[model samples]
Target: MLQKADQVPAVVAEFIGLELDDAAMARVIEYCSRDYMSSHPHQFDDHVLRQKRESVWQLPPDGTASKAIRFSAKLSLSPALRARLDEVWADTVQKRLGFESYAAFRRSLPNSLGVTRVD
Candidate 1:
C-alpha cells in the first residue's frame, strides 16, 4: 500500500463501487498517505489499547504509552533476530511474494527512509 499510495483512492473507489469526484479522490489519497496517517495515529485508537493494557495487565503507563504507533522503518532488529526473521520469511512468504529474501523484499520498497539501530 505504501509503495503504490497514489493508486489507493482508485482501488478503494472501485472496491466500494463508488465514483468519487476529483475533490473526494484527492481527499482520499491525502488521508491514506503515510505522512497523514502517521501524524494522526490517534485514529488507530492506541489510547484504547493502552487503557486495556493498564487495566488487564496491571501495568503502569510509561513514556512509550503515549507513542504506541510505530513505523517498521524506524525499528531495528538484532542480527540474530533478523536472520531468524529472514529464515521464517523464506520458508513462509518468499515463494508467495516472489522475493528471494526478506532484505530483497525490503529493498524493493520505495523510499524506505532508514532503520534505527536499537543496539
Candidate 2:
C-alpha cells in the first residue's frame, strides 16, 4: 500500500463501489497519509486503548502515561529478541507477503515509513 500511496484513494473508492470526485479523493488520500495518521493518533483509537490500559493497570490519568501507539526513530532491541522477531516475521509474514525478508520489505517502502533502523 505504501508503494502506491497515491492510488489508495481510488482503490478504496473502487472497492466500495463509490466514484469519488477529485476533491474528495484528495481529501481521502491526505487523511490516509502516514503524516496525517501519526499526527492524529486518536482517529485510530489510541486514546481509547490508552485509557483502557490505564484503567486496567490503575495508572494515574495525570501521570506520565506511555502512548498506546508511537511513531519514532528510536529502537532498542536486544540481539536475541531481534533475531526472534525476524524468525517470526519470516515464518508468518514473509512468504505470505512475497518478501524474502523483513529488511527487503522495509527497503521496498518509500522513506522507510514504519521502520526504525537499528544501526
Which candidate should be chosen as best, given lDDT against the real structure? Answer: 2
lDDT of 2 by residue, 1-119 (tens): 55667776776678789998889889988887777766875675556767888899998765433332445466789999989988988888886897877677867766423335432
What candidate 2 gets wrong by more than 4 Å, as runs, is 60-119
TM-score list, all predictions: 0.50, 0.47
Q: What local lDDT does model 2 show for residue 84?
A: 95
Residue-wise C-alpha lDDT for candidate 1, range 11-111, written one tens digit per residue: 76887899989999999888777677768867744787787888889888662433324465567789999899878888888868888875677677653
lDDT for residue 89 in candidate 1, whole number 0-100: 84
